[model samples]
Target: MSKLILLFGGLLIACLSLSANAAPLNPLLAPLSALTAKDIAIIANDADPMSLQIADYYQHRRGVPADQMIHIRFNPKTKVLSRLEFAVQKKRVDEKTPAHVQAFVLSWMQPYRVDCMSITTAFATGFDEAFCAKGCELTRKSPYFNSISSLPFRDYGLRPTMMLAGNSFEDVKALIDRGIAADFSQPKGSAYLLKTADKARSSRAVFFPKIAEGFKGVWPVFYMEKEFIKGQDDVMFYFTGLTQVPYINENRYPPGAIADHLTSAGGVLSGSKQMNILDWLKAGATASYGAVVEPCNFPPKFPHPGVLMANYLRGSSLIEAYWKSVGMPGQGVFVGEPLARPFAYPSK
Candidate 1:
């Protein structure tokens, strides 16, 4: 409901909606021209062992074309890259990228942030200050939000990107394995949208009514007012807001399942006080989103549940659904298996 906000005088009036519009609310049950392995370019840090290994494994696993693999050299230890330094390397990446490529998968976890913007955003759309917010103000809006177009790079000159990020080689391999396993495997899964107690962070809940209404017969919609879900055996989509989501590992996330807790700095995969988005991957979720910086509890800074599930159920790939869900993604870092498409079918 980031777009639902309206201001009068000096007051920030919160607007809530129950509109079940078909476009984003009741998405038609149909396959989309999802971002495929061929449409993605893998950006790997050759200097980092983990980056190289993950890139190689993902390439073979997803059948990504040999030419799509992009290798660059950078310091492996730096978690944050300076804007000036990143621009030089990014220019090289831009020159090497094929025009047909629609998105990217950054293989390394470190260097996740470039100045105030997430590395994923930096790589996808270039380092633009319009995407960065100074205070609680809104940043640049993503052109791909709830969009029907599949050719992002060609159309908007923006590549919707994600990261093959995990703690270890095995962890990332397992993550990719889950993605490969999800292809065309439409399992009976449940979508969990928790309206937690955190008022500020729970800003995305405005769209829950419409989302729940749309997924009524298409999927199991579980809209609960709780802090966390535990011991669930089949969680396909779990959305909530909390600083530290407890018992996340106790729930089972099927392949291609998307789960995320809305909080500041969850995208700070390492050395964050909040429960990192990596924990979502470790706990079996195939994809997740978080803010690498302090993106105040504005719904635009996080994934819109309505847009995400609607796009995913309509058969968009994990990366597409996640990227299109966020209105303002400058601060948010998207990390997931790029090609998971459980709900997608082969084009007839």
Candidate 2:
């Protein structure tokens, strides 16, 4: 009996080692505790009251160091910035940022696009005219994707940026609180990857099977075809393509849920029939992404559901996981509380 027990224990150990080796390296598994308040830099437009308020609230809530707060004076209502204006503003931000800062939080909605590149991408890789020369071609890849380093800029020379944006200050505050609540909770939830009849938007459908296999046992993965998901609770992640409003009102997403719809103008803050990404936040999602400019239904320009789920399940922050999922993000604006990490520490 003693010999049998020993053999069984040895086999268990061997199996566990094999499983660990087979699993892909998830950078999000690295704890945010590894990052200090000093590693984040918050930017606000001095002329925008909402920007100032959001920046202040995020700084206080995240415990970011006071020295890391950088302010600039720019047209707060403009949706696009000229090359020269963007260059000057980027220079100002770069100068004010401390060398140790690893991530950036832009507290504004307008000026989401700089020339042809999204403001987030410009800040991460610096503006490249080549990226804008072709509207449909693949843009540069991010160095921070699948990276193990928590200090992205220090390790990979790339600073991941997220906009603390919404329709109003009150909304932004609520979003921030939700992110704070998600830390280390590891709540039970599901990831819904939907396939619609629209072929251009349905490109992600090919990845659904792989996602289900990859995330099996980690979370319930649901794959739907030509059908809408509704009235679900504890929705941890959702991705789909739709031109108009989705059936989000029918669902109840928990605090850390990451949801987004792939539509051309989802990033447009106002006056569009397409659902705004901010509506996801309003509907209880903690983070979301959308294209500020026309991306022509390119899957690479948007967040890949498989990549996002894989990283998030491994405990990556919302911003990090979402950012890594996009192979070309020059046209998309990422919105959400950047530090929401529900799976960072497994729940007891």
Best by TM-score: 1
Q: Candidate 1's error at 26, in angstroms?
A: 9.7
Q: What is the alpha-carbon lDDT of model 2 when measured against the actual structure?
A: 0.75
- The TM-score of predicted model 2 comes to 0.88
Q: How well is each residue in 181-282 modelled by candidate 2, as lDDT tens digits?
A: 988887888888888877777766766766665555446888888557878886888888887645787898888898888888888765477888989998
TM-score of 1: 0.92
Runs with alpha carbons beyond 4 Å of true place in candidate 2: 1-36, 346-348
Best by lDDT: 1
TM-score of each model, in listed order: 0.92, 0.88
**lDDT by residue (tens digit), candidate 1, 1-348:** 112111111111112111212123222323565889889999999899999999999998888999899989999889999999899989989889888898999999998999989999999999998989888888888877766777888778899889999999999999999998998888778989998999887888876766676555557888888888889999999999999999988988889999998999899977678889999999999999999998898887788776777667767899998988888899999998989999888776
Off by over 4 Å in 1: 1-30
lDDT (C-alpha, whole model) for all candidates: 0.83, 0.75
